[model samples]
Target chain A: MQWLNLLNANFRKEYIEMKRYLPNTLALLLTFYIIFLAAFFGIMFVGDPASFEANVQYSIVSVAFWSLTLMTMNFIGFSVVTEAMRGTLEQLYMSPMGVWKIMLTRIVGQFSLQLVMMVILLFAAMLTSGQWLSLNPMTTIPILTLTMISIVGVSFMIAGLAIIVKQIQAFLQIFQFVLMALVFIPLSVAPFLAFAPFVKGVDMVRMVMMENLTLSAIPLADFGFLLINSMIYFILGLFVFHRCEKLAMKKGLLGQY
Target chain B: MEKIIEVRGINKQYVKRKTKEVITAVNDVSFDVHRGEVLGLLGPNGAGKTSTIKMICGLLQADAGSIHINGLDIKKKRLKALKHISAVLEGNRNLYWRLTVRENLEYFAGNRGLSRKDVKEQVEKLLKQFRLKEKENELVNGLSRGMQQKLAIAVALLANTEVILLDEPTLGLDVEISYELREILKMIVKEEKRTIIISSHDMPVVQELCDRTIIINKGTVVVDEKVENLLKLFETRAYSIKLGGTLSVAQEQQLLVKFPLCTYEGSSHETVVNINLEKSEDIYDLFDIFKAEGTVVESIDRTTIDFEQVFMEIVKGEKAYAMA
Candidate 1:
C-alpha cells in the first residue's frame, strides 16, 4: 500500500512536469520522430531495394527501442544530477521510504510515461514508413517488462555515479549512443552481447516483433536466460548504486554539484 | 526528558581535492536532543555545525561514532531511523522550485509513502499555518525566499516526524520575514512539541526559540548549555558604571590592566565604564580603581547579556564552558 502511494505520487509528479514542460517534451518527441524519419529515408535512398520492407520494419523497431532504452536507462542519472543542482537531493535522502525506493518509483513512473510517448513514436514511425511490424503486446509486454528491470538496474548504477560525481552530463550525453548500439545491433551478429544489461531482452522483443513469435513459441531457455540476465544486472545495479550512495555520503557529495 | 536524538562521538573529515589535505569538519561531537526540546546548533563558518547536522540527518556518514534517532541507529537502520526525523537542510533550496506550493507539500509527503489523501488535511493545515494558502498554486520559483523557506519547512512538518532539523531556517531573510519566521517557529515549538534542531547564525532565533544551545568552533563542541543559563552566566558578570567624574591617568591604566575587555566613555562631567568581568569578584577590583581615583560613583547597573554576546564570548574566547 505504501509502495502504491509512492508510485501514484511519482506518476502524478511526472505527468504534471511533462505537462508543464510541454515544449521540452514535445521537442523530445519531435527529435525521436526526426530520427525515425532519418532511418526511413536512409533505408529508402541508400539500402538495397530487395530487403526494403524488412529493412524499414527493422529500422522502425530499432528506432523506437533505441529511444526507449536510452531514455529509460539514462533517466535516473539525469534526475540525480538535476536534483543535486537544484539542491533537493539531500532532502530526498531524508525520506524514510529510502532514496532507492523513491528512485525506483520515479523510474517506473518515468518509464510508463515514456512508454506512452514511445508508442506514439512507434505508430508515428510506422505511419511515415508505411511498414508495420507486429507489436505482439502479449509477448512483447512481458519481455519488455523484464528488459526494464535491467534498464532500471543500470539506471541505478548511473544514478549512483551521479550522486558522487554530480557532473555526469558529459558521460550521460555519450551514453545515448552506447544505448543506440546496444538496441540497434542484432544478437546474432554479436552473440556474446547476451550477457549485457537488457541486450537479451531487447533481442528477444525484437525477434518477437519482427518474426511474429508468441511467448510459448520462443524456447524456454531464452526466457530463462533473459530473466537471469535481468536479475543479475538488477542486483548488480542496486549494489553499485548503494555503494555509490555510501561513497557520496562519506564524501559529503550528495548536495554538491 | 526522553531523548529523541542521540549523537555519540561522531566525527567527519573532508579531503581537499587539490591539496589532498584532510580537514576535520566535525570532531568527536556528542549531544542528545530531548523530546519536545528546541536545540540551537550554533557555530562559526567551517565550525562543523553543518557537518554535525548532516550526520544527524543521516545525509553524511561520520568518520567515527554513531547517531540514533528514536533508538534506531542511523548507520544500521537508516531508513527506519529516518522515520523519526526530517530536515530542511538547505532552507528554500530544499524545495522543488518548479513545483507549486501545494504540490511540493503533497509530493514530499508522497515521497515518504504517504498518499495525498493521507496528507490532505495536513497540506491544508500547513498551508494555512505557514500563511501560504493564497499562493498555494504558485510555483515555488515565483514565491519569495521567505515563502519558499516556509513551504520547505511546511514540507518537513508534513512528514509528521518526531524530530525536525532546520539548518539556517532564516539565513537570508530580511529582518521582517526573519522575525515573522521566528514567531511562527515559536508557535510550532510551543504547540507542536516536536524536537527541533535549528542551526543558524541569527542569534535572536537561537535566543528566543532554543531551549538549549550547543556552540561549536573549529570542529568541536565549545559550549553546550541552556540559553537562559548562558545569558545569566554572562549577565551576572557584566556591569555598566556611571561616574560623577573622569578617571585619573593611573586609575585608567589600572582599569585597562585589570579589564582588557572593558570600554569607557568619558567627558568633562560624566564618565561611563562598561565591563564584563571574568569573575563576579573582579567587580571589587574595578571598584578599587575607581576609589583610587576618588571618582564619585553615581550609579552601577548590571548589564543584561543577550545570547549574541554569550556566543561571541564563547566563540571568540574559544572557551570550553563547563556546565553544571
Candidate 2:
C-alpha cells in the first residue's frame, strides 16, 4: 500500500514536471526530427526511383522505431543525473522506500509518458509519408513488452553509472548511436545479432508489421530466446545498479553533483 | 531522559578521486541522543559533522562502528531504524523545486502512508503553520529562499518521526528570516517534544535550542557538555585586565605559556589582556607572571561569555593542546 502511494506521488510529480516544460520539450523534439530523421530520409530515397517507395517505408519505420528505443533508454538513465543535479536525489533517498523502488517508480512514470509520444510519432510518419504502417496491437504488444524489459536493463546500468560518474551526457550520446545500430541493422543478414539486447524483439516486430504474422505464427524458439535474453539482462542490470548505489553512499557522493 | 539513539566508535574514511589519498572524515566519534532532547553538533569546516549526521540517519554507513536507533541496530534493521528519524539536509536542497508547496507536503505525507483525506488535511495544516498558506499553489522554485526553507522543514515534519536531523537549517538566509526560523524552531521544540540534532555554525541557535552539545574538531570529539554548564564553566574563569603599560616580551611569553587561550593587544600608553583559564585557580599563576616583571595591574574584571565565545575557547583549547 505504501509503495502504491509512492508510485502515485512519483507519477503525479513526473506528469506535472512534463506539463511545466512542454514547450521546451516540443521545441527540442521538432529540432531532432528536422535534423536527424529528415536527413536520413533524404539520403535513403535519393538513389533509385524503383526503390523509392520501399525506401520511404523502411526509412520512416526504422527512424520511428529507433527514436522510441533511443529516447526510452536515454530518459531512464538521464533521469538519475537530472535528479542529482537538481539536489533531489538525497530527498528521494531519505524516503522510507528503498532507492531501487524510487527509481522504478520514476522509470514507470517517464516510460508511460514517452509511450504516448512514441505512438504519436508513429502515426505522424504514416500520415506524412503515406506509408500504411501495421497498426495491429495484438501481435505487436507482446514483442514490445519483451523488448522493453531488455531496454530497462540498459537504463538501470546507465542510471547507476550516472551516480558514480556525476556527468553522463557524453556517454549517453555515444550509447544512443550504438542503440540505433542495434535496432536498425537487418537481423536476416546476421542472424547472430538476435543474441544482442533488443535486436530479436525489433526483428520480430518488423516481421509482424510487414508480413502480417500473428503471435501464434512466430516460432517458439525465437520467443523463448527473447524471453531468456530479457530476464538475464534485467537481473544483471539490477546487480550493477545496487552495487553502484552502495558505492555512492559509501563515497558520500549521492547528494553531491 | 531515555536514550533514543546510540552511536559508538563510528569511523569513516574517503579516498581522494585524483591522488587516491585516504582521508579520515569521522574517527571513533560517539555520542548518545536522548528522547525529547535537543543536541547540537558544532564543528569547523571539514570537521566531519555532516559525515557523523549521515551515519546516524543511515544515509552513509560507517566504515567501522555501530549505530543503534530506538534500540534497533542500524546495519541489521535499517528501514526499521530509519523509520524513527527524519532529516532536512544541506540547507534547502531537500525539497522538490518544481512542485508546489502543497504538492511537496502531500507527496511526502503520502509516502509515509497517510490516507488521501488525511494527506489533504495535513497539507492544509502545514501550509498554515509554516505561513505558506498564501503561496501553497506556487511552485517551490518561484518562492524566496526563506519560503523554500520553511517548506523543507514542513515536508520533514510530515513524516512525523521521533528524531529530526537539521543540517545547517538556516544557512545563507537574511538576518530577518534567520531570526524568524529560529523562533519557529523554538516553538516546534516546545510544542512537539521531538528529539532534534542540529548541525550549525549559528551559535545562538545552538544555545537557544540545544540542551547539550558535542563539539568536534579534526574528526574527533573535543568537548561534550551541557550548554548551561559550558557557559558557566567559561564565565567563571574568563577575565579582562588593563595594564599600566606594555609588558616585556619575556613576561608576555610567560603569560602565553601559562594561558595559551589569552589575547594580548598592546600600545605605548596602555595594554589589555583577555584570557580564559581552564580553572578559576589559574588566575594566581597569571598574576605571578605579571608580578615577575614587576608590572603594575591597573584593573582586573571577570568577563561574561556567550555560547560563541565558549565555542571559540573550546576550539582554541584543542589547538593549544595540539601545540603542547
Candidate 3:
C-alpha cells in the first residue's frame, strides 16, 4: 500500500513535468522519426524488394529495442542529472520512502510514459517503411517484459553514474550507439553473447517476430535462458547502483552538479 | 525536554576532483537539538555548517559517527528516522519546478503517506498560512524566488515532521520578504512547538528565533551557547570611548596592535574608539595605549552587542564557551 502511494505520487510528478515539456518532447520525437525515415528510404532505394522486406522487419525490432534503451537509459539517466542540478536530489534523499524506492517509482512512471511514445514511434516507422510487423500480445508482452528487466538494470546503472559523475551526457551518447549494436548484431553468430545485457531478449524477440513462433512454441530452454539472464542483470544493476549511491553520498556529490 | 536530534561524531571529507586535494568538510562534530527548541547552526562560509545539517537530514551520509532523530538511528533505520524530519535547503532546490505550488505541497504530503482528503486539507492550510493562495496554481518556475522559497518551506511543513531543518532560510531574500518569513517561522515555532535547527548566516534570524546556537569554524565546533547569553557576554565587554583630543600615529598603531578588531572613527579633533575586549581587565591595556599619547579619556559607553558581533568574535577565536 505504501509503495502504491509512492508510485502514484511519482507518476503525477513526472506527468506534470512531461506536460510542461510537451514541446521539447515532441521536437525530440520528430527528430528521431526523421532519422528513421531517412534510413528506411536509403534501404528501399539500395536493396531489392525481398531484402527490403526483411530489413523492414529488422528495423521494427530495432526500433523496439532502441526505444526501450532510449526511454530507460536516456530519460531516467538525464532525469537524475537534472534533479541534481536543481538541488532536489537531497530532498528526494530525505523522503521517508528512501532514495532507491523513490527512484524506482519514478522509473516506473517515466517508463510507462515512454511506452506510449514507443508505440507512436513504432507506428511511424511502420508507415514510413510500408510494412507492419504484426505483434502477438501473448508472445510479445512476455518477451517485452523480460527485455524490460534488463533495461531497468541499465537505467539503474546510468542513474547511479549520474549521481557520482555529475556530468554523463558524453557517456550516455556513447552508450546509445552501443545499445544500437546490441540490438542489430545477430546473437546467433556467437552463442556466448547470450550473457550480454538485453542480447537474449532481443534474440528471442526476433525469433517471435520473424519466425512466427508463439510463446509456448518457443522452447522452454530458450525462455529459461532469457529469464535467468534478465534476473542476473537486474540484480547486478541494483548492486552497482547502490554502490555508486554510497560513493556519491560519501563525497557529498549527490546534491552537487 | 527530550533531545529530538542527537548527532554524534559526524564527519565528512571531500576530494577536489581536479586538484586531488583532500578537504575535511565536517570533522567529528556532535551536538543535540532539544524538542520544540530552535537551535541555530551558525558559522562562516566553508565552516561545515551545511555538511552537518545535511547529515542530520539524511541527505548526506556521514563518514563516521551517527545521527539519531526521535531516538531512531539514521544509518541503521534511515527511512524510519527521516520520517520525523524535513529540510528546506538554502536554495529553492527542494521543490519540483514544473509542478504547481499546490501540487508540490500535495505531492510532498501524499509522499509522506497522507491520504487524498488529508493532503487537500493540509495543502490548503499551508497555502493560506504561507500567503500563497493566489499563486497556488502557478508553476514553481513561474514564481519569484521569494515565492518559490515560500513554497519550498510550505512543502516542508506539509510533511508534518517533528524536526524541521532550515538551511539558510532567509538567504537571498528582499528585506521585506525576509522579515515576513521570519515572522511566519516564529509563529510556526511558537504554535506548532516543532523542533527547528536553522543553519544561517543571517544574525537577526538567529537572534530572534533560536534559543541556543552552535557556532562552527574550520569544520569544528567553536562555541555552543544560548543566544541571550552570548549577546550578554559580549555586551558587557564591548565599549565605545570618546577621546578628548587627537592621537599620534604611534597611538593609532598601538591601538591597532592591541585591539585588532577595534574600529577608530571620527576626525583626529574628536576621535572615538569602538572595541570589544575579551576580558574586562583588558581595558587597562587599551588605556595604556591611550595614555602613551597623553590622550585624555572623555567618556566610555557600553556598546550593545548583536548576535553578528558575538558570532564574529567567537569565529575569530576570541572566546569559547564550555558547552553545558
Candidate 4:
C-alpha cells in the first residue's frame, strides 16, 4: 500500500512538474525535430534514397545514445538539485518517503519525457530513410541496460555535485561538455570502445546504429565486466548523494534556500 | 501528563569547513510536550528554537540526544518515530508549488497512503476549511505569502499525525491573516486531539495558542513554564506607580541605582514610574525608599503584562528564570 501511494504520488508530482515546464519540455522535443530535419536534408543531399536513409539512421541513433548523459544530467540538475537549494527540497526528505525515492521518481520523469522525444526522432528518421545500428536483440538489450545503469550513476553524481556546490548551471554545463567529449567522443572514435566500460556500451550502440555489429560480435566476458563496472559507479553515485544530503542538513540550508 | 514528545539532553554543534570552528546551536536542551497539547518553542532571533524544532521533527539528526515520539526512539526507529509527527518548517510546507492547492493536498495525502476517495474527500474539506476553495486551482506562485502560509499549514493538518510542529506560523503575516491563522490554530487544538510544538518569536501566537512555552536563548533553554504561570509571575512582579508630583533628582537617582530593572518615565504631564521588581520583597524596599525620600505616591498598580513584554524582559536579562 505504501509503495503504491509513493509511486502514485511520484507520478502525480512528476505530471505537475512536467506540465509546469511544458515550454522547456517542448523545446527539448524540438531537438528531435532538428535531428529529423538534418536526417531529411542529409538524405536529400545524398540523392540516393538508400544512402540518405542509412546516414539518417546512423545519426539519430548515435545522437540519442550519446546524448543520454547530457539529457539526464541536466534534467536532474534543474528539477531536483535546484529545488533542493531553494529549501523546498526538504519536503521530500522530511516526509515518510526516502530521499532515494524522490531522486528516482524525478529521474524517471526525465527519462519518460526524453524517451518520448527519442521515439519521435526515430520516426522522423525513418520517414527520411535513416537507419539504426545493427543489433542482436540479446546483446543489445543487456548492453544498453548496463549503459543506462551507468548513466544513472553519472546522473546521481552530477546531482550530488550540484547539491554540494548549490549551483547547477555551471556544473551542468561542465558535465555536458565532459560527457559529450570524454564519454561519447571515445565511442565515436571506433569499435574498440566496447572494450572500455567508460565508453564500452556507447561503442556497442554506435556499432549497432551503423549496422556493423550485433550480439555475437562481443564476447560474453565483456558484458559481465561492463555490468560490474557500471554497478560500481551507480553505487558510488548514490553514496555521494546521501553524503551531500547530510551536508545540506548540517548547514540547515534544507529550508533556508 | 503523558508526554507525546520528549527530547532528552539534546546537544548540537556545527563545525566550519575551513577553520573548523565549532558553533554550538543547542546545548543539553530538554523539554516535553504533553499529548493533545500546544507547546510554544519560543526564542529571540538567532536563538536555538528553530534548531530544536528541526531536531524534534527529524529534519536535523541531533549530534547527541534521544527524541521519543510516543516513547519510540527517533534515532533508532526514525520512520516509525516520524509516523506520529508532521512539521510545517518555516517556508517549506511539504507542498508542490506546480501542483494546484488541491493537488498538493492530494499528493501529500497519497504520500501518507490514504485512499484516493478519502484523500479527495479530505482535500475538499481542508480547502473549504482553509478558505482556499476559491483559489484552489491557482498555482502556488500566484498565491500571496499569507495564502501560501495558510495552505502550508492546512497541508500539515491533512497528515493527521499525533504531533504537529510549526516554525514561525505567524511570521511576516498581516494582522488579519495572523488573526485568521490563530483562529484556525485554536480550532485545531479544540477540535483535533494532536500535540503541537510551535517555534516562534511571535509572543501572542505563543501566549494564545500554546499551553506552555519553552524559551531558548544562546543554545540553552532559558524559560520553561505554563503560559498562565509565567503571565501570572510577571504580573505579580511588575508595578506601575503614579507619583503625586515630579520626583526630585535624588529620589530618581536612588530609584535607578537601587532597582536596575525599573523604567522611570518622568513627565510633567504624567509622572508614571514602572519597575520590574527583581524579587517579590523588592517591592517593599521600593516602598521604603519612596517613604524615606518623602515622595508622595498618588496610586500604585501592578501592571497587566503581555507575553511580548514578558518575553523581552526575560531575554534582556531583566527577568531570568531557571530552565531545564
- Taking the tens digit of each residue's C-alpha lDDT, what string does model 2 give over A1-257? 88778778778878888899999767755654564457456756564877766666666557666877787777656887887888878777777677677677777787778777767776776677666767578998888889888878878888889889879999888987898788778897888888888789988887787767888999999889999998888788888988998888788888788
Per-candidate DockQ versus the true complex?
A: 0.87, 0.43, 0.51, 0.41
Residue A173 in candidate 1, Cα distance off native in Å: 2.3
Runs in model 3 deviating more than 4 A are B113-115, B237-302, B319-324
* Candidate with more favorable, higher lDDT: 1 or 4: 1
- Which regions of candidate 2 fall more than 4 Å away from where they truly are? A35-44, A47-55, B110-118, B239-302, B318-324
lDDT of 2 by residue, B21-77 (tens): 999999998889999999999999899999999888787889999999999998777
- Fraction of real interface contacts that model 1 preserves: 0.85
Clashing pairs in 4: A53-A129, A53-A130, A57-A130, A57-A131, A133-A208, A133-A209, A134-A208, A134-A211
Q: Rank the candidates by TM-score, best first.
A: 1, 3, 2, 4
Q: Per-residue CA lDDT of candidate 4, range B221-306, in tens?
A: 88889999989988997789998667778877888899866787776745788988868998888888778867788899999999
Candidate with the larger TM-score of 2 and 3: 3
What is candidate 3's lDDT per residue for B22-114, written digit by digit as tens? 999889898898989999999999999998988887778898999999999987788899889999987767888888888888778667766
* Residue range with the least summed lDDT across 10 consecutive positions in model 1 chain A: A201-210
Better of 2 and 4 by DockQ: 2
DockQ-based ranking:
1, 3, 2, 4
Quantify all predictions' global Cα lDDT against the true fold.
0.90, 0.82, 0.83, 0.75
Candidate 4: stretches off by over 4 Å: A32-55, A129-147, A181-230, A251-253, B15-22, B92-94, B112-115, B242-275, B278-298
Per-residue accuracy of model 3 over A173-206 as CA lDDT, tens digit each: 8888888888778877777888888788888877
Superposed model 1: Cα runs more than 4 Å off: B248-263, B284-294, B318-324
